[model samples]
Target: MTRPAAPPFAASATDPIRSILMNTLIAPETDQRRPEFPTQQPRIEVVAPLAPGDEAILTPAALDFLAALHDRFAHTRHELLARRLQTRVDAANGRDPKFLPETEWIRLDPEWRVAGAAPGLEDRRVEITGPTDRKMAINALNSGARVWLADQEDATSPTWGNVIGGQRSLYDFLRGQLEYTSPEGKEYRVTAERTPTIVFRPRGWHLVEKHLRFHDRAGRSMSASGSLVDFGLYFFHNAEALIAQGSGPYFYLPKLESHLEARLWNDVFVFAQQELGLPQGTVRATVLIETIQAAFEMEEILFELREHCAGLNAGRWDYIFSIIKTFRSRGRRWVLPDRTQITMTVPFMRAYTELLVSTAHRRGAYAIGGMSAFIPDRRNPEVTERALEKVALDKRREAGDGFDGSWVAHPDLIATAKAEFDAVLGERPNQLDRLREDVEVGAADLLDIPSAGGEVSDAGVVDNIAIAIRYIESWLRGVGAAAIDHLMEDAATAEISRSQIWQWLDNNTVTAEGTRIDQTSIVASMAAAVAALPRFEGDRFDDAISVFREVALAPEFPTFLTVGAYARFF
Candidate 1:
């Protein structure tokens, strides 16, 4: 006998989004270059939404969606109404949630998107150094970065910059009171620096509690007793300070497990905002969604922090290891794919992405993809080109599949990543249209703002045209400022990420008009946008390119990066 359909109260048809997701052509349009979007009617599929700890409260929207489905079918089968609410007690099967009369709903984990602002060698053509030290920091900022993540966490000059993350320094920095020089020869501005923007990843709760000392009673300093207690302490202190400072830097919450964790974060943010005398709803969040439970609870995780969570990003290696250790014994027989392969081509990644995009788009947030850590080897131009081709294709496919942006670990790769991000975006008018429509239709939701560690910001997204122009404009600037050889270390990695995000636009960017580029330049061009930097006017660009190639492709490279590493994703 066939399994019974759900009761009348349960959705008579599949959710509209699920229907639309089917046959959704996500590939970027080769001609218009528009990424594919879902356009079909909803397809119904049976799924048990409940996981062990999942709880469900039918939101008004879910209720409305159900009503719409019931309206669509006039003479729907009588069995539907009877079986929809079938009790687990009646079935006697243990596969379903034990709780009867409760809708089975396991929220999926949210995906995270890397900001265009944070500093990294891959995103920005420059490297960021130092915590509050201006010369080193500015040198890194001026070199270029979509965003300079003011270090507090992993990239925080582990030794020197550690002090700068203190409440006072963090507060002043966020207020735009910090000063620094730009690599473009501009004198340092005193009040604050904006061009090379910053996103601060706070010290992981564990480290801050252990290492960073704070003032105590009677104005004396003391070591924290417990990391767990210190997590709450540091979070409250720094998170509140940031809110009071009025800076727009957002958050990157790491090592989470479920919606409850996100809710805990949301609770902290709410407390910080209230006590810090800050405006409400100014902050936005980027959830790492790294753990196995997080992946399963994505929908609810975001639900709690609806408006606060701006984007959900898929973390790579860290998450893979997290998954393995979570159930090593149970999954031992089912070995994971090769490390390199897992990084690029995620086998069941679609399930997660679909749930992420489906729920995020359902709730209205940007769906950002994860990182491609490979830095193209320029020694053999072919090696670099081949690596580039693989990820470019992957990113292109991701965008087509509904991701708004992706991450690259190398600064040089930032231009490539952004160019691909923009290429997939197609016309500006269309983008504006989609955003306006989505936001207007009540698509976006955030439970709280100014998420954990203050990582994601409400700062403007780099426009496709802006991203394209910079990639086409700069040439030698990056090569001279930084090295692109291998991103094994965090500094080189940070430089690459920063240059790609921070300082690519100019005062005239909004109004300037020119098509100094074409498809041919994009397709056949193997040159780094930085290679064309104004600083290197003549053979300088070529020489810099040569330097990059020599270093990047040197045979003394990592054993795995041995040759064409991009193919590993596949």
Candidate 2:
């Protein structure tokens, strides 16, 4: 039986006007003019202190745009988040997700294809991912990468300053006005010759931007969705400028679990384009197939966003985290090994990437590969060499598998990644013509967790604890993309660390040395993890430890560590 059709934006049970507002705002006007705003503008309460330059980005008009976005879509976002919890609960209860029968037509229909590469995104052989701070922005734009993932999600700690400052950096960069000077008299500027196509990644639907509160008509107030806040502010401020530059406001949509979520994003794109008086398909988005559930619905997701879809990215780190989280309660078979052991070549991971490439190519979309997290340390030649070798190997594998491009966490690895793609792609912008047809992946192949074939280790547990603590400390200090032991660590990697600990403890996993991973053992390991780190003057180790323990040791697994951390601390 087909699932019942419902309005794209349903009214909240408590807020009847939500549906009316959504219809009025999202519905294309008769003459194609901008949608009329509600009579009483939704009150936007700024809770965080605005820095001196924030006013340029958060103008009255921009805030009004943000408020309208919130008022129209916040209710639907809430529903989707609640649906996520219920789906996870169902998965925990053994209702494992399969390819949707209702959407079988979407998968089987072979003629449908996503909107092919936008102008600047034609040759994305090496995309660099980083936070949008001034120095990093300058370095990334100069990194010789084909694309720069201006990340506001995993790579950015959601401090108010970081949020608004990130927008300012992107705004100035587009206008050729972004530059920085160091205390030691060093200069950094964006050289237009080497600048990459900018693809912005807003936060996922699960997070809230506490700095901005949206007050409804009846004086009801709630935090705005971080996804809308990030997307709205950037689109409102820079859409026209990007268009004038012959590129659109492209995006990397992250952590989507189902095609319905993709549909919502497609609608948002449509509404944003209509509101901004641009063409319907002007904005393009690449969906990250990072969750296990999303793997099942890849074709459907592409179909959902066909008009505005750019392609699909293999978000390898978070994909592993999603597998662990979805099946955490399903017993020992679901337990994962060390984060380092879960490479893209593992059986399930290989299945995921292979399927991603095949599915994307079949749908006429770009099949981007996963990130190489090995950031080179310039001081240590040996470490840098190892990183280069590791990155080359990974990128070579992806290119061989017919991937159009891949991601690198650091500028140093960009050449290593691009060289592999260049060896395969040659003068061609992409290998989209090399459709990978022999790939056949089933649900069982994707769920073959035991195929990973590595043992849980004492050292692995210690590393998980230590890395989680270290990364959390960095996050608390307003640093998101942190280099720990020569590898770039972000929220996705940290999620794997803490979630693995919880899975191990919950399942009574015994290490290879026969030590049962229980609460007592975890406490002992926590001390070792803490002691191993060097002390700094303004470290938030105490709070970091508390946050790690709370999420990792909770009876019920937290959907995302960042959600609670953002709520309680920031």
Candidate 3:
């Protein structure tokens, strides 16, 4: 297949910038090579040079499909992102978020139910999650879990290679051609009798793919939306093959803040299916209820995507980060304790999960639980024993609380998580019949932040700084998910770590040892943390510290660390 020609650019003094916190500015004008214009029609130009394997994924037809999707929905996506900023400002200015009065009818009319699970998604007892690198994709497919969350969102670093290579990985996975060989002569391939169902997660709408620039009809040029690029490429290339294999083009939508966003996605699905001549409802999507704003509009979101909705996943890590980010400017009462202190058993988290289960089940959707980030280590039997015990307890609680399935980061914990769900759902694909009508959650329950009562210790504050620095360094090296201190750390956990630092500094939080969390103390802790880490070749500690300070210690807060980091470093 021939590659698409680079599109022409109108002369400009500077590169265009979408919202800073959302789409972010792309590469500066002087650094890019200009190609001659082919035609006046709206076009997409590949700014980054194609790498070794990118030819397989970035064919001319695939780029055309991406341009079509962006042209149809880019305007609405921008409007929705602007609305998100306004909503955040309102929350900071004491306009508390309550259930929408206008949408009360949607909630009151209980007859509506989402399109249930598709063929392979009927029983998702154990779902494994990881980035879509070739090795991880192979391991996840052969992990014996019912589903593999081929994550490109929080779990991916968004390097130019990863962004395109991930799609290539999935394209190869569906064709049974994914395999990896280590330098030590160990070979890894998909060898399981029954592979897991594949659920691809594209990046959130807030991100922009700077490697590709889109020129609209009016001759305005900006970076392409990451969400559209990821979804467009994957669906355009693999939708037909997946459907023929009895698995539709299923997805897990991340970081949706409102029902309107869900509605926008529904429109995208409708338009894409029509463009491809597929059935209207051939796509299935599971929305991650990761934001506080989304938790309030669960039923409304379900209603909007009813035709293509699969269920909701409790994105617990991002949910915590959302709480801190939404209420960062508020008084100390809205401040949460250390991340270690906030468990699912806390009144507020419990309220959120219970409400999620009841809300999803009431609307005839599967209710999936949060991830257990603990990865068992065989080198130390004691560590493995403790990790398994902790994972078992967490899974048991989720299964007993009416969750159909739960997520595990590593393959070792799949059996434990599946065992818990299996004990509760014997000979049954799911527990959609167990509608937890008893879960009555009010606005006050979800906002009960003070109910999570635990003192902030000096250790907690220091750990936040350490984890943020470590994870940011790994991200800078193009690795999104890193095993840190025996736990799987991703962008969500790193967001929580950095957000807590900002929240603590804003609120003058005093640790249990009478030490105040101020700029001085945080800087000292960061320096110490860096010194403690073992140095490796090509490590990004210096850049990581600079990025961490800009996001965590600055006077103004960035909505997402990845947004700015990606724009600047990647």
Error of 2 at 34 (Å): 8.9
Model 2 agreement with the true structure over 440-536: per-residue lDDT tens digits: 8999999899999888988899999999999999999999999999889999999999999999999999999888999899988888888898679
Q: What TM-score, over all chains together, does every model reach?
A: 0.47, 0.94, 0.93
Task: Give lDDT tens digits, candidate 3, residues 307-353.
Answer: 99999999999999999999997989988888889999999999999
User: How far off is residue 303 in model 2, in Å?
Assistant: 0.6
What tens-digit string does per-residue lDDT give for candidate 1 at 422-502?
A: 775754311211232222111111111111111211121122122222322222221111222332223223222222122
Candidate 3 segments whose C-alpha is farther than 4 A from its true place: 1-42
- How many residue pairs clash in each candidate at the backbone level? 91, 0, 0
Error in Å for residue 501 of model 2: 0.4
Candidate 3 — what's its lDDT? 0.88
Cα lDDT of candidate 2 equals: 0.87
- How far residue 237's Cα lies from its native spot in candidate 1, in Å, is 9.9
